[model samples]
Target chain A: MTLKEIKELLQAEVICGDHHLGTEIILAGGSDLMSDVLAFGKPGLLLLTGLTNLQSVRTADIIEAKAIIYVRGKKPDDQTIKLAAEKNIPLLSTPLMMYEACGLLYQAGIPGVSPANNSNKAND
Target chain B: MTRDDEFRQTFKIKGRDFSHAGGVSTEIKEILQEIGIPTQLIRRVAIASYEAEMNVVMYAQQGKLILSINPETIQIEVEDKGQGIKDIELAMQEGYSTATEEMREMGFGAGMGLPNIKKNSHVFLITSTPGVGTYLKMIFYLDHEKAS
Candidate 1:
């Protein structure tokens, strides 16, 4: 699905990179831990996270995430926004919690980073 | 620049500087991109480099990240002055961590940093002294056939 469709479906607000909404995002992964994201995230992965900090944006850029959606109505500070814009990684926020946001996206056919392998279990 | 030409640069990292923690890694990524490293390989380098930088910011007083590139390989060396790992074997485990709540709040500290670095690099080495510091050397081969 395109990021524009995700914005509409989740009723999210674009915090940065408004011009990037047309980008395609077929896979996503949610985590507040940047370590897990780095370990599991693939190129062009859409990151769903609740951590509203500069690291989130940095992690997205490091892993080559297409975009980020901050859940639970959380938003990052100005520095974070600036970094996101600089990296060309779009940032969005939704009022829904992490669970609901993941469910909605899953229901909409956007799969997690590794749906079949369950690589996250190794971290558990 | 040709593959045979060597490139080397060093970036300093300040501990507890959450505001600018990952900047060096991002800069490293940009440098690799400009040098025309493969996207997949660049991603691996970026991930490993970011995790190493974060380790310095979270645990050390200060550190230096050195990037070296040659015809055959890309190498990163991170050396930090701070409380070093007491048990390297335990720290290498998948889920072992000694991160504080503040570290976790910043979206890291789940103990995957070193392991993730090792996973992404074709050759990895780590050495530390409990009271002194830690040093990590990671190398990625330019020839994709030798990467695994």
Candidate 2:
């Protein structure tokens, strides 16, 4: 779905990358741990997290995530906004918590980044 | 362009510096983008490099990252001075982490660093001495026809 639709659906505030609201996002992943995101996230992901650190923006950029949706009324600091702007990664803030945000997106037809197939496991 | 066309760059990483942990990887990604590498290859390289950077930041006193980019391959060598893994085998396990509260606060240290790096890299090599440090060399093969 287009980020524009996500913004409207979640009543999210666009903190940056207003010009790139039309960017399409194929999958969504919500996590507070940057490690998990790095391990599992892929390109064109929409990341939802409550962590408001600059690392969040950095993680999204590294994974080539389309945008970041800050959940639970969480907001990113100026540095995060500057980095997101520089990377052309859109930032959105929503009052809903992580679970709710992810649920809304899932119910709206967005799939998670990956399944429980455990394909990422070395043993599997 | 072929393997003859290669670019090399080095970046320094300081430990426990959460503020700028991923700076080197970000710079590398920008460089790859400017060089017109494929998006998928860039993402893989960036992710692996960033994970290595974080490992250095969270565990070492300092580190050096060398990025070698050829027309058909991208390789990164990360060497760090700090408490190295006593058991490389255990460290490679997916859920084994020695991270502290401070490291966790930065949204990292989930014990997924090495595995994730290996997953993203086409070639992964690592070595460490318990008290000395660690070295990681990761490479990504670029598809000539696929890369823009």
Candidate 3:
């Protein structure tokens, strides 16, 4: 799915990267653990999370994620926004809670990842 | 841009301020990148740097992280002035942490900090006193000949 679809489906606000809504995302996952996201995320996946710290943006930076969706209407602070701008990471905020956000994205055809096998690959 | 005689940069960290927690690690990452460190090495340093960064921020009231880089090795030292770990052996175990709810909510303090650092680094050490403080060090050895 594309960022455009995610914005529409989750009813999210595009806090940054409005011009890049056309960027396509292959897979997505929802988790509160930034370490797990960094530890488990696939190369091509988008991250949906409730933890909207600057570290969250930094975690997205490490993995080079497509975008980040802040569920439950959490808008990032100025520092986080500035970092997102610096990193060129697309950031969004949604009123939908974490579970619903994941469900909508999944229903929209974006699926969660199985990191057990991926962890082995990361180890290798 | 210039490092100490043997080490690259030695920074003093003040813990629990929360705002400046990740600053030292970010700087170290930038320097290593500028010096043309390899991706695997860079990522390894980042993981260790970040773990060490969070440890000082959340666990200690005050601490310092030092970064030293040379042709052969990259070394990081973190010293903290918090209440030291009660059981070093158990704390080394995965899925163990003394992190508060606020810290955990931020997605760190997952009990993987030490383990991740140990995994990424070639050599690791941790020493702590219950009333005094804690000192941690990690070294990543690089064969410059092989890398070049």
Give the top-scoring candidate (lDDT).
1
- Each model's TM-score for chain A is 0.92, 0.91, 0.90
Error of 1 at B23 (Å): 0.8
Residues A21-116, model 3: lDDT tens digits: 999887787888866675566555688988887888877766667899999999888888888888789999999999999888777666667655
Compute the lDDT of residue B74 as modeled in candidate 3: 84
Best by DockQ: 1
Of all true interface contacts, what fraction is found in model 1? 1.00
Q: Which lDDT tens digits does candidate 1 get at residues B64-132?
A: 999999989999999999999999999999889999999999988898999999999999999999989
TM-score of each: 0.94, 0.90, 0.83
| Candidate 2 residue-wise lDDT, B32-83, digit = tens | 9998988878888899999999999999999999999876678899999999
The TM-score between candidate 1 and the true structure equals 0.94
lDDT tens string, model 3, B20-55? 666677678778888898867877777777778878
Residue A60 CA error for candidate 1 (Å)? 0.4
Docking class of 1: high
Native A-B contacts reproduced, model 3: 0.27
Candidate 1 TM-score on chain B: 0.96
User: Which CAPRI level is candidate 3?
Assistant: acceptable
Q: Show the colliding residue pairs in model 3.
A: B13-B64
